[model samples]
Structures are given as C-alpha cells and as structure tokens.
Target: MDTLVLRLQPGDDLRAALDAVLKTDGIGGAAFVVSGIGSLRGAGIRFAGAETATRIEGDLEILTLAGTLSPDGSHLHLSVSDAAGRVSGGHAAPGCVVRTTAEILVAVLPEWRFSREPDPQTGYAELVPRRRSSQTL
Candidate 1:
C-alpha cells in the first residue's frame, strides 16, 4: 500500500477533489481514506434511509472522514460539527465546499482493484474487491 496526503484549499469540493485523485497517474485502482479532517463552508450529507442529501450550511468542521475509493465510485462517511457545536454524520456526498483547508490521508492499494456491482441482497451497487492479476503481496 502507498500513502497519499492531500490538502484541499478553500472553495474546493471535498468529494470532487478526492475523486480526481484516482485519475492521477500511478495512483492505482483502489484506495481507502484512512483519515480526514477539515473545515467546510457547507456540506451535503445523505442521512440514513434518505434518498437525497440534506444541505448543511454554516461554518462546519469535519470531525471525521473515512471510506473506500474505487474506480467505479466511492463510498465515504463523515461527521461534522457546526459553529454551535451541533454534530451531524452521514454518507458523504458531493457539493461539500471547503472553507479553510482539508487534510486527507489515503492508502492506495496498488495490488487490488475495486469495483461496484449490484448486489441482490442489498439492492444497491456495492464494493467488490479483487486482487490485480499482475500484482502480488
């Protein structure tokens, strides 16, 4: 596994930036967000069982961020605290705009490939991890 540390500037979209990392040359086909913390002007979080994300507006601090990254897509979860110290956590969605800076640590798995496939049991596309034939531990 290879490690990557990223710093996102103000106005950057948290999810979009992370997505772009996968497209970078030599990054590999799969990664895991080991840790992340940052500040956001606002964020969009999809709560449990909710079909759509709820937009949260304010000076928010990202308390936690972690998840899987795949070529097909990513599944991330985050927790944030508002200026008032109110906390909210849910599935991380796009449109989370950075306020100050976002520091992220990712572990790139070069020997593995991750894809999203429809699962009959969950009725949703889920992560499918596989080893790369050309690589070995």
Candidate 2:
C-alpha cells in the first residue's frame, strides 16, 4: 500500500484539489487523515443535527477534518473557527470553500480499493470495503 501526502496551496479549493488527485491517479476510493493548523479567510461547515446550514464568517482555523473518500460518495466532516474564535464542525457540504489553503494527507492503500454503497437502514451512502472483502486476515 502507498500513502499520498498532498499539500494544497493558497487559492485552491480543498475538495477540488483532492478530487483532482483522485482523477490523476485513477483513484476512485481512499481515505483522508486531515490535520489543519493554519489561518484562512473563512469556510462553511454543517453539523450533523442541523437541518439547515449556518453561515460562519471571519478568520478560520482548521480544527479537524475526519472522513472517507470513495467512488460512491465522500463522507467528509470539517471543523473551522468563527470570528469570535469559536470552533465549529460538521459534515462537509457544497458551500464549503477553502479560505487561503488547506493541507491534506491521504493514505492511498494500493492493494485495497474503496467504494460507497447505499444502506437502506441508514438512508445514506457510505464507504465500504470493495473487492478485497473476500480476503481474510
């Protein structure tokens, strides 16, 4: 398995950059181990319980980003700061825009491929182990 360390520069969209990497490497699935510790203009993050998105404005600092990446869909969560220096976190939605830059490190397991499937019980798409499921430890 190979690990990919990606550093996104200023003026780049965090999500978009990751997508580009996936396309370039022909990677349809993977996982992101995010550790953001920098200043940004601002960003939008949606919590799980919130029905509607709340606007968080001002200097933003990445607190944490934990989630998965797959062909089916991306289940990402983001945490950013507000003008009052309050921290906010939630599921990364469409409105999320990178302030200045975001650095992300992804563990690209070459031997294993990841994908997303809809679970009737959950009513949402989530990352799932692909072909390697048959292989036993």
* Top candidate (TM-score): 1
* Model 2 spans > 4 angstroms off: 26-28, 131-137
* Top candidate when judged by lDDT against the true structure: 1
Q: How high is the CA lDDT of each candidate model? A: 0.94, 0.64
| Tens-digit per-residue lDDT, 4-120, candidate 1 | 999999999999988888899989889999999999999999999999999999899999999999888889999999989999999999989999999999999999989999999
RMSD of each: 1.4, 3.2
**In candidate 1, what residue range of length 10 has the lowest lDDT sum?**
128-137
lDDT for position 65 in model 2: 71
lDDT over C-alpha atoms for residue 54 of model 2: 69
On residues 1-137, what C-alpha lDDT tens digit does candidate 2 reach at each position?
45567666666666555555556555535655555444556565667877766666667887777676665556677887776778788876654566666777776654566777778988767667755554521
